[model samples]
Target: MKHLSLSAQRFPRRATSAVAAAAVAFAFAGCANYSGISSDKQIAAPDKFEATQSVPGQGGQWPSLDWAKQFGDPQLPQLIDEALADNPSIAQAQARIAKASSYIDTSRSALYPKVNGSYSWTRELYSANALFPPPYGGTWYSENNALVSASWDLDLWGKNRARLNQAVSQEKAAEADMQQARVTLAASLARTYNQLALLYALRDVAQREIANRQDVGRITNGRVAAGLDTNVERRTAEGNVATSQTSLTELDGQIESVRYQLAALLGKGPDRGLQIAKPVIDPKVNVTLPDNIPADLISRRPDIIAARWQVEAATQNIKEAKAEFFPDINLTAAFGFDAFGWSKFLQSSSRQIQFGPAIHLPIFDAGALRAQLKGRYADFEGDVANYNQTLVSALNDVATNISAIRSLDKQMSDANRALTAATSAYQLAVIRYKAGLSPQLQVLNADDNRLANEQTVTNLRLKRTDLQIALIKSLGGGFDATSTNLAIDGSGQQQAANPTTNQTSPSQ
Candidate 1:
């Protein structure tokens, strides 16, 4: 082998040593010391709900996905689909999700190097008295240059990673919020639609009552003409007719009001809502509960899921804040051509390369960094509290709906029995009056009782339907929290974690 001179090898060795020393210095100076916090920290959670008996599902089973179908209304599903597609609230939620997803991209960009390219052309005049002292006394020059530059921030303490984690969590939270909006819109539409249906039924009832009263008024008028009844009875029958007409009028106003509301929910004009036909709901439809309703299903509630993500995002924010207390290491490099003249700039000899590491130490901030960390900690604590509160509220909502449904069921049964007895009594009284065995007043009283009982049954049925809708909403409208993958770690990396199970601490 040919031996190289020591002089030649010495320069290369010295250059290599210089680069190694610079790297060591940069690493030491830019070292960050941070104790990352994990989102796995435990908070208070209930193992069982207070009103467990109200749940009808079997253990480990959740509510059916097609819960709205239980109403037996064919138009309901179509209405819900339209609302989901057109409702302003749902659209807003979806926009937020898109915004959050963009944020995730922004945060992730920080983890990698950024490369930029530029080209410039300039004409300049130099003063003879200036430092440049014009190349030739005072001269104008034209120059063209093209350059490429690259820079990257080294996440020595996972600061960028933490930011990315926060972004991911926020995106997941937004998704949950969107789901929540869908569930809420569906529930509201269903409730309003049910109300409209009930109103229509009530209006029919009023019409029937008006007809009955009118018949009574005619009979009383005939009796008075025949000297069989007094003027007082005729006036009483007319008063009853007036009352029924008033009820019918009021119901008409209510129906229109509800129609307007439903139209708004459908993202349409009031006139468009009036075009919707009267909803057909089976009054006897029963929502079957699973044999065992596990309390854990509350976690599947979209609100609860969103709350949990907020908490995790807050935890990641704390990590990011803590990381800021340490030094930041950014590496920048540029390579391109530069020269006083366009011809020279294009020459290979004009090519230049420059590279170095920039370090930023948190030397003097007047406790600003500490204050930020404190605020982040406070925010995380607040989020945790919110999560707990939301969970509890969700459980309470389910329990309340269950209790209401059970009570309504009993009331419906009793109302049915009363309606049956009143109807029978009214039929008997009418027969007796026709045969001249009972007074006209007795028949009027029986008819009033029957109408009242009928109204009770109708109102109770509406209440039952409302309760079922409430129960579905409380149960998250069949949202499955487990379908989402949200992972919050100090490193800002998403790892699949089961929301139903306690999350393990993420590796730094």
Candidate 2:
């Protein structure tokens, strides 16, 4: 390798400057027009959510990273862990992260120089009819060449840097997506487990009702034999017992169905569901909100975080698109040896060296550059809108769940009172009939009312548990964005972590 220097005497400095000025003028004049196009979408204000007002569990405990454990269900946490570890969705999200990382590497590479080397040899016979010297006419000759080349895009307009930033943002989004998948899977599994718990509770109630109905049937039969009640009463009592039995059977089937759903959520076969023991959940789980209701939600929810990153990526894309309208300047250099014969290739006389600046700009591409810039702006606006929508929906999700949970708390209290009253009335009716003071019809009616109240209370409790899980999910399933590389500002803007200081600064 040899270094070649340029002499001002050979290439006058005055002429060089003239050429550079002309190049710059031409570059500017031919640059594509991209003015007056930009995104106008703004992030939704976090405080707009009205339901974030002070509620029952406001300022209480926020869901921990292991939110499933808070439910006091031993099997649920294990099931959620298995689902997160073994689910195909998790694997798919991991693959996306790997792919996004690769893109980052690819984009980052453009910021550096590239070098290549090549060697070639060929043998050919010259035609006699061609213009050639008599000695070489119609003769076979060998051609050999070896070359090394290097090029570096100066990126004076920051195009490549913008692209790199875009890739980084996409990678961050992928990471957030994976976390979102984990949150979704864990929450879904826990909710399904809660359903299984509710089914078991209902089944218990059904069994008790069946026994109660059978006692009524025996009482009716005794009354009919004594002519204290008509045959119609005895037949109706049999029908009541049959109805309760049918309900118990249906409850069993439903329990099996819910088990199957749990099996699927666990990413396992149906047989695995059969192995699951009954879920024992603490019924006193209460709804709680973190300190920063909607503000912290921006960073907590993975969907919102992912959407924000997408907006960041789109912003970078606009920068990149704008850069394309300017001159693309690069430094190119080559050192090589070329000769007609192999013997001369290694000689100093065969050496060749070249270096220069290469500049290119869009002269006329039929408005392609402008169109690309316009498309980039559109993409940015769309991403911004998407981010805003996601944030709004996330806040509302939390609000809705909290409201329902609070409402369910009130309903549960009323339901318990109704159940207690119905129980007392059913007992009184049974005692009166046994004492021959009331008809069998009255006892049957009271038993039906008691069963209905019992079912309502059981269903409401189940709903409360399900809502608690939903609320946890809505609160981001214990995700902590500050723990990750990305950070969120109070205004809900995304900030990048500074590699040197390991601190977050607002993204430009």
Candidate 3:
């Protein structure tokens, strides 16, 4: 805080004004030119993205904070809760928030006065040839000094305030980033869970296929014993059963692999996945899209919010850089005592006081200051581009998920009809084979078609569930950013406070 000697010297009023005027004139003469470095990027208007504009649905309060509950899976909410609480990513985000908060304190401190106290004592022998008097020459003496010093930057150019604002903006960005992390984590886990459900459904179908194959093998053996079928026919039927069993084995391994993935997503050991129950996803539980999606998306998506805050912080950084072009004034004062002996140190005669204004301005630094200002401008432009890109991508994600869901809905309907036909064909082939109207190969072929169709229907249904989760995530996973005033106009207004503190619902 004390950059210059605090001598107890006073300047005349007219002399101080003249010095200030000269410094001001020199500061402006040496100012950096930042005119050509302005950012041209603008935040992309939400309405300009056609895909988001045509999304249907209105007046629906979808994906509340407890969005996971809509899946009707009792275990899903608990797993997401565990991941949020125990995940390393979440912990890292929390630590960043703490660090950013501390910076706010550090920046805020500059707006106030700083005071320090110190004391020193040294015993030394005075040299005979030095300026010591005859009584003190060639003698040992103790020098004691104590002082209390204070300094405060007047901040007439608002440099410190701009710095403080920058810190605050960065903190808000960190907060939004943490929320984004949560949304990502929960969405990933849910999608993985949906995969687990799909695997279970497939496994069930495999088991049923195995059963059907075994029954066909039994009938073929009976026909061979009665001279109605050859040993080659029986062999074929047995091979079909073995093939189904192999499929079942593969499905089981896939199911376990998914369990492992789910466990990892839950931030737990592999054994934790073993304890996970089969997912019960209810496809009938519809996820309604919120109305005015693109208009409100800026506040809904945490990534967009965070990017916007980054731009806000960069604007403040430019302000701080510009402020550096002006003079910095600090009032410094020191009060202390100095004496050769401790006895005299406390005496009023030994007391000293000094106070003065210290002014600093950038007169010349080659091109370093200019380069730094230019860099700040460049950072602002980069942040603006980043914000614009994030907003565009967020809208694209929403639109992509919406369109995919609609396509999947139609696909699932077709798959269901196909599955029904396959089921009927398989039933008819079995009846015809038993009545001696069709060969055993016909029944096996029909059953294979039926199995494929069943797996297809199951997969499509579960995939639709996964997309529902994606849509919810694309909608910000119920994160309410309404209170986060993401102003990018560089007007230097304080951002609105978000009471959620950058945390999404752990249950989400």
- The global C-alpha lDDT for each of the candidates, from Candidate 1 onward, is 0.75, 0.81, 0.79
How many angstroms is residue 482 displaced in model 1 relative to the true structure, after the best TM-score fit?
2.8
- TM per prediction: 0.86, 0.91, 0.91
Candidate 2 deviant stretches above 4 angstroms: 1-18, 48-57, 488-508
Using lDDT, rank the candidates from best to worst: 2, 3, 1
Clashing pairs in 3: none
Worst 10 residues of 3 by lDDT: 499-508
Model 1: residues with Cα > 4 Å off, grouped in runs = 1-41, 46-51, 54-61, 133-135, 291-295, 484-508
Per-residue lDDT tens digits of candidate 3, residues 1-508? 1122222345666776776666566655654444444444455667766653547655778576789997899899989999998998988899998999999999999999999999999998998888987679889999999999999999876778878978888988988999999999999998998898888888888888888888888888888888888999899988888888898898899889989988888888999999999888887766777787777888889998898788778767766776766667788888899999788999999987877777676655676656887787678778877977898888788888888988989998899999999999999998888777899889988998898899989888888888889989989998887654443432332222111121111101
Clashing residue pairs for model 2 = none
Tens digits of per-residue lDDT, candidate 2, 375-423, equal 8767777887788789878877877887888788899999999999999
- The 10-residue segment of model 2 with minimum total lDDT is 498-507
* C-alpha RMSD of candidate 2: 5.0
